[model samples]
Target: MRERWRQGRAARRAHHRRRGLRARLTRMFALVAILAVVLTTVLTVGATFRVLAQFGPGVGADTAWDAATWQQVASGAGRSIIRSAVQAAFLSALLAIFVAGLVTRQLTRPLARLADGAERLRAGDRSVQLPIPPRQDELRDLTATFNDLTLSLARQEAWRRGLVADIAHDLRTPLAVLRSEIEAMQDGVQPLDGAALARLHGEVLLLARLVTDLRTLSLAESGALSLEPRLLDAEEALRGLAEAYSVRAVEAGVTLTVHASSPLPLHVDSDRLRQALGNILDNALRYAAPGPVKLSAWADGEGTHLSIRDDGPGFRPDDLARAFERFYRADASRTRDPQGRASSGLGLAIARALVEAQGGRLAARNHPEGGAEFTLTFPVPSGEPPSPQTRMVTRAPSSSR
Candidate 1:
């Protein structure tokens, strides 16, 4: 019984294992052979009479085809005609074989690639780069579509990993605080009061801020961040940001200086412009020595630039390279705020997003003499973005904001 079942299964499998060409080619060759005989007979008869006419015209188109004469004509004509037809048919078959091989190979290349890709996909290999032919025809379009699917899948995988990490990190601190609060209350070690309530409030706020920043950054990167652009008073924007950061700087024992060329207006969103300055100011104040925080703005022909420099231990020479990556903190400056307080490391990343959404540019670098400088540049009020200068260097790929 088992042997019979196994045989049945094997037969079923064999049913789908297609014999692609042998059966079809055999039938086609049989049909060609029969057609060739009829064609040869017809042509031979016509040729014999015509050839016999050159021997004599007295048959008057009614020459009696006697057995001997007919047999002789048939034998001679059939041999010659059949031989030539055989040669011609062989040559045609050889040519057809070569042409069929070429066309079949060309047409099946894409199908072959599709098969290979399926095998790799079964093996879970996502980085395979199977390129499609670059013709403007249907094959090219199909290849392009496959490439897009591969890229989209890769991106989604990466996004999944990143989101998981971000979420875990985001949850860790807040959860730890909440746990500690509950433990303290349970043990009667600390009473729930104004101080405890405030701490809890702060932690919740921090958690909320992280969620908000993540959403904002995602929106900006996905091209969904909306902008409200207008003519910006660059001087006013700088002054407001400087004032906001001055108190924080003074508390940290750093002098704050805000300088602006009077009323330099720009084609920008006022709120986003202020956010850009605020981010620079916060970074400067956070890293500056207990000495000075300098914020300055000026217009240069077709564009305007704002600079914030701090005397504190500014960014290291290489730290400028990845300053705007979300959650990244410089190795030397990941501690507390100026007053020895904690901070979410998303400030610069959020600031960069806002700047980019408005089609502007921002970057950070080490000051020549000493310290760190963040420069945010925008096209001046001439209604178009300014062309970059010959010697000016770019550190980060800036946004259009």
Candidate 2:
């Protein structure tokens, strides 16, 4: 009963506030109209009195009455004029009140709709979209903005739902594996040997990796990730990464190479940069087997550019558009490797996040030469010049592999 009373009182207060807009507008319009009528009436009465004073017997006239007669005539005329003016003013005020009502109604209709839409939105209705007004005015602009706000809210809500579902799906697989392995050992169906324990450990590691990647992605996206940025040689970094991953490339029957036409300087977090590039390179080696993967770096007027290109089946149109969405795999075959190791599908998303957190942009496109290309661009810091050294480094696949 107390809750009901509270709600009722709140509703009453809201209604009271809502009524104020129309009341204030009506009062304002009526006040202006009444002031205009009164001013006109006053001017008309004053003009009549002035004319009477000028033309009556008191003034220089040829055939006028005596002063007392003139005074009486003026007084009677003044009374008649005053009566007509008062009657006209009364009628005008009534008309003004009626017009004020219509005007206020027209003005508050759109506002009322907007208020209702806002209330629905507050009530968890993400799809509430208000109709825009037809007239080109401030009200119409406000309505358009509100519609845009609703659209953005709907998109965010959808993304949130998708994120939760993806996380659950990714977690369920490794968890199932762990449960099954433990159950088998407990039932004496499988020996609790080194191989079995190793298998279980691998699944645990997968789970840990997924959780870590999710945390990193969240931090990067929320601008809460810590970074230690400094000036670094972009060309050298590319060469170093290429050398580090060359063995893996060769193991997969792929050739990994780095090419730099000139020295390129960049201001960035070295560790983060390596992390982003490593993710892309790993993807390239995984999918572009038996083909060539190339890393290139250069600097131009725009900024420093680092790109990884692979001579494999390029990305499909849909993949190119959503390659960075978390846990979005273009093909079901991409869900696991040939060795049966599951993919968390957050590699590209985390890479993009890390790059963007450092004020750089990452983009994916199908190379014109028939392969996939991922590029990273970073802005050059002020007062820093590119190295003048004109050198190039290239590493090729080992013939023994």
Candidate 3:
């Protein structure tokens, strides 16, 4: 009971100490108005007495009045002026207070709403949004900024929740498989043979890959990914990538080709760029089996452009919109590669993260020739020019499937 009493007393003190901005502003305006009225009245009364001394009771007249009469006349006129000035000042002061109240109310209403909305936000309500004032003033700008902040917080919260769910769902499948396999072997329902061991090993590898991809993605998105950037010939890099993946293309019965109009210079991290390119190529090959895949590079006034086009089915509208989302696959049923290896569904996401980390952009769309195309653009640094070699290079495998 004593503790409760202490709490109640503290609450009372806090309430008393809470001086509102509206009240303070109103008081300030009232004080200023009253001061102005008093100052004006004093000046007006002084001016009236001076004028009376100059022209009243016989000054500049044929018959001049005595000093005593002049003094009496001046006193009477001064008193009358003071009385009228006081009355006018009193009425003006009242009007000033009323206007001050109205103005202060108008100003403080938005501030009060903002404070309430901020309190709600502090209590973990991300959706708290204040109504924006219609007046084109600082208050409106402030409210708009607050609304933007609220929207950003909401989006981040949603993304965090979705990430957790996706991680759990991805982990559950491989874990379940591993547990079931081990349990079956222990129960003597399945033989401890090479195939069984291989299956278990595959699940373990899938789990490891998923974890690694997640870490890389997290680091990239958080701007912590280390990059060793250098200037390199774009044509040479494309040729090297094509050569590296030629064997895979041949096995998949796909024709891989690289084309460059000239030696385009690019400044980027070589290893990271290769990884991003490899991931996109792998994705294209996965879907465009037995079809032609083209790699083209060029530099223009805008930037350096690298495009990969695959003669396969393009993305649906929904898939295109969410292509960079983690663990988002257009065809949910196909979760494994043709070789029966599990896919973590983070390839496109990782590619985008890596590209963006290097200050570049990646985009996907349907090519005019009815195929999926992915383009990567890297901005040229200021005061830098394209490579002067100007040699056009086109590399293709000697044998095409």
Candidate 4:
């Protein structure tokens, strides 16, 4: 394998040597310079001879020139023409050299800076920012793209650090609970009763759930999450989910309703889609007010659209921006559910990832009237993408409600 890799690299280098950009440009400039010199010499010699031919005969005819006089005139004229051609060739060569030098300098400097920036980035420098080339050309575009890439990588690195911290924090609580309980029982400070055993079991469950969610997210992000896609009726899916969550909504004292403007078809991984929808529905039911939470479906030119909106206190402005971030909770200090159960905060993040893996988009926004709305747009195989046109609508809060 190593030998094959080395051979492939050598082949590529040889190919580049024959047709590299810099080499091609250098050859072009050399050809142009040589042609300029040749043309200048030819034109200068021809013009000089033409002038002598027209003037030399007048001198011979008017002066009764002898063979010696003719020889002197011809020799001087030839020397003059040769001198002029030499001077023209010399000037052309100088100009060509100067232009070639400028071209090489302009091309090589930017490329060197780009290479240096890449090296710095590889060495873990997130602050590397390449200056955009001034010329409005492909090189300028390349520089701009490099800057964008560096910025994106830096942001991803920061997010990764935050994820690690969040995961540690999430794991610490359950592990601490289990350790404390076991230690207490061992010290005879606490009895190993049903209550104590149940508490330990709950902590284990929480840890299991957190681990599973982390695994799912990792798989989705890495494109390792497999999907079994089928043609699904979008309207039916929405109705079914709304029905499934209705009981939870009732338990939470929130009204749940499903509305389908029209039937729409979609090709998707049903189980994955349901998992994503369940998370969204769970969030809506958890945070919504006693008013109605609507799940609606419709078809547009862009494909099928499903939205879940609640009349609850809308997301805090800051939370709205990063609600989909993994392990991100709005109330950071309040880490438990309303029932005081531990929460992983991976629901929306997982939902977004699963939806995206199946060629869909999941987004959240506050309803204009009052509340948060989560919209899932799934593109049909035969339909246009939702990016060009969106058909989700925001309704005003009813005064009567």
Candidate 5:
């Protein structure tokens, strides 16, 4: 155990040390080479001056430093100054090679990390994080940019896994429901009354919801999350969500409330805004234990705002941090809901993506008063179309949700 601990400490210390030494060595070695060149220049100038002085200030073939004695001066300078310069140049070049090698080693650290990260990704590791240096040097920026890419890749990998699991789990519930209903009919245990038919219909509706959400996810991932911004009534948007989910809320025994401080006006993608609002509302209704589902919107100093809060079982610290991760179910069990109903869990992820794609921000938190609140903040139109439209989205057929 002690040997293992020592090895760990050594590795950590070496890693931290290597993190900066490349840049440091590069600057130091370049400075030393320049200084050496400067020194050689000064010495060569001095040798020229010494020869001029010996020639008695008159540069002529017959002077003391002239033809016959010029050989001595020339030989002396070449034997000493030129040779010394040659040696010095060779030494500095050698030093430069050493420094360059060390610096290159440091620089390649990121490349090595990139390779390792790629290999781990290839090996299906979604938890890899690349080490990047602090400043914004070109190589450091490249490393940071690569790490950012890796981070995004890791997130998408996680999303892909969640999507598969959600699909399997989602299919199980409906298939089981349909299977049970079919078996009952075959066994004549329960007559295929409208009530029994209604259960299958509900299952089909749930399946439809799952399919719709999955298709949306696929479209979003394929870079087709397009939007058309327009000036719309914020209250109307909130009302749309309320109206869509009103029946579901009623069936779930959850009250839906729409509170807006009089038509909060804003510029936004109407359909995307509606979808975001619906997702939040749906999530609140689905997860909240018998309680009120509150939808509220208003204008703050920054922009228009909308939130859906529920007096449900709120998230814990871990869950809240990753609540927007696609299909990340805090309640992973199948038997936790009030009516044993479960979710596909992509609601919040899609909601936040849509919100952000509109030059807005969305966040989820546990209300101090005992529920979870998701807030979407949008920037008010600044009297001009944003440059090239919102950047986080790609173009697709426009729709009003």
Candidate 6:
């Protein structure tokens, strides 16, 4: 155990020896400059010694100079050169240290600020704004990334708070109604009968549906949703969705129709696809004007496209942008249906999430002809070639519509 502890301590010491960016960079510049100065000084001294040796004693015997005099001259020249070189090296080292200190501080200040901002963010302060410097460098890129992270976190925090509030609001209405009805019945004010019981049952069902929708959304958001994908008839899927919602549409004084253009085959999660399409149809039936809601499916070179168009007051221009945001309703009028039943605003958001999870895209637009239309597009899966017979097939309008 002692040996193990000692090894751990040694490892930590080694980790600390690996210095941060500024210290490492400063040491690098200082070492390079010191090396240059030392090399220059050494070369200068060596050249001086060589020159002195060449002219001294034996080679100068023919000249007037004696061996002792030559030795003295050589010795004096060598000392002077050595001293001069030492002084120059010392001065160079001082300059290197000063320059390195300046450069290190310049590079490290931005990173220090970034570290502090990160800590603040972790502490739940989303208002920390990092001012990006004008310099085109890694620090600028880092600052920009940090800024985007801050903005994203702020938006997510806001959305979280809004979701909590919306959920509470939704749950409160049904619960409050149930409590009041039960209390009234207990006090002999409202008698227990078929009528009163049905009202209570309706509230219970509404609560159940809201909880179910929330669960679906949660699973889809967390990437925990299980999907079973297979190749299936796209036309059949559309017709199935239309038939499921046809009764509700008729009761709401709206006509629902499905127009299949061809033998459209698509690889998708059949049940999930149905849920998404059903949500779209339900939304149309609830909010659209009393007119026909058309569902159509067609195949093209790109892939398969399914559209649901409703003859209603189309989405407001501003609302169109955020139509898929969870718990978002365009206005108060959208809260309840004509029969005073509440609508869970998570339908479109969940539908989009489910569709995208299956490698498809869902989009909404104001149809030029009259109302709002939602289009779902899925690309042909890889390794699955389009069938040669899958040509564009448009059927004439059915006489029933």
Tell me the RMSD of model 4 versus the true structure. 9.4
Name the lDDT value of residue 39 in candidate 5. 71
Q: Count the backbone clashes (under 3 Å) in each candidate.
A: 7, 0, 0, 0, 0, 0
Sort by lDDT, best first: what order? 3, 2, 6, 4, 5, 1
Ranked by lDDT, the better of candidates 1 and 3 is: 3
Clashing pairs in 3: none
**Could you say which candidate leads in lDDT?**
3
Kindly list the per-residue Cα lDDT of model 6 for residues 72-124, writing each as its tens digit.
87787787677667776777777777876887687778989999999999999
Report the C-alpha lDDT of model 3 over 272-352, residue by residue, as the tens digit: 999889889988877767788989887787789888899999888998899899999888887875657678889899999
C-alpha lDDT score of every prediction, in listed order: 0.68, 0.82, 0.83, 0.79, 0.73, 0.80
Tell me the spans in candidate 3 whose CA falls farther than 4 Å from its real position: 1-96, 382-384, 387-401
Lowest lDDT sum, 10 consecutive residues, model 1, at: 392-401
Please identify which of the two predictions, 4 or 6, would achieve the higher lDDT against the true structure: 6
The global Cα lDDT (0 to 1) of model 2 is 0.82
lDDT of 3 at 216: 93
Q: Say what the RMSD of model 5 is.
A: 11.1
lDDT: worst 10-residue window of model 5: 388-397
- Pairs that collide, model 6: none
lDDT of 1: 0.68
Model 5: per-residue Cα lDDT over 332-360, one tens digit each: 76323456554667788888777777778
lDDT of 6: 0.80
TM-score of each: 0.64, 0.81, 0.81, 0.79, 0.65, 0.81
lDDT of 1 at 376: 80
